[model samples]
Target: MKCLLVSDSHGSETELSEVIERHRGEVDAVFHCGDSELSNDSSILEGVHTVQGNVDKPGEFPEDTAETVKGVRVYVTHGHLYNIKMTHIPLSYRAEETQARMACFGHSHHPTAFEDQGILFVNPGSVMQPRTRPEQTYAIASFDESGGAEIRFYERESAEEVTDLYASFPAGTQ
Candidate 1:
């Protein structure tokens, strides 16, 4: 399965639509990492999975979300409750409890993806308000019930993949 990962759009209807159109048939899922602040649009509800960010005025976004997509246990959160800007301790704890192979979160507006402690942590950066000496960025992930997962990060406008990573949990662990 392929998934488009986004975060911190802040409220860009056009960019959101661009994401949808860019990955239309390319991926099976589209995940908004956080900070969309689109409580009114709800178009996200159509073909995306999302979590509430610190700025989100919520209607139905869960603090933490878990979903099984194409046989992978995925975790979603805004990372504020996890104190992501400080560290991933809180998010790590939840991943252990959930046995989630992949955990996605956003708050720092930096695009990153990595593997540690048998879990994959991803932050798709601020697609709108990017920080930390980089252009606005987002990410995507592809998975199979095989050895590992492949993740890629891209500049929003050029769609240039600037970073890539591969993750594989130890044997007999998910």
Candidate 2:
């Protein structure tokens, strides 16, 4: 299964809609890690698994969510609640508690993907206002039956892969 992960749009509805449209039908699922600054009923969020961010209105969205996609258990969150800017330990523990093989989140707007103790943690960065890199980014993750997984980053505006930001985990990692 393949899934799209994005976050921190910070109110750029146009960019968010474009990214979703660009990957429509190309992935099994779509996840937004928050700070979208859009209403819960926004059309752009239809069918998207989203979480509330620090800036989002309280009670509009859940703080975290978990779901199984094609046999892969994924946990989604905005990261602020888990103190991601300081360390991923808390977030990792939460994902473990959820029995999720992948933990998707965003907050720092720094695109990153890595595996920690058999769990994959990915941050797709900010599509509207990027921090570390100049290009607004998002991530596409693919999972196979044998536990093989790979994450690839893309430039949101161009829908082009960022070849250098790819990460692949061996079957046994999960």
* Candidate with the greatest TM-score versus the true structure: 2
Residue 151 in candidate 1 has what lDDT? 79
Please give, for residues 1-174, the per-residue lDDT of candidate 2 as tens digits.
899999999999999999998997899999999999999999999999999999998888999999999999999999999999999999999999999999999999999999998999999989988889998999999998899999999999888999889999989954
Cα displacement (angstroms), candidate 1, residue 156, comes to: 0.8
State the lDDT of candidate 1 residue by residue for 34-153, as single tens digits. Answer: 788887457654668888888888655767778877877889888988889998888999987898888999889977777778788998888889888467888788876673687787
Clashes of each: 0, 0
lDDT of 2 at 102: 97
Error of 2 at 153 (Å): 0.3
The lDDT per prediction is 0.79, 0.94
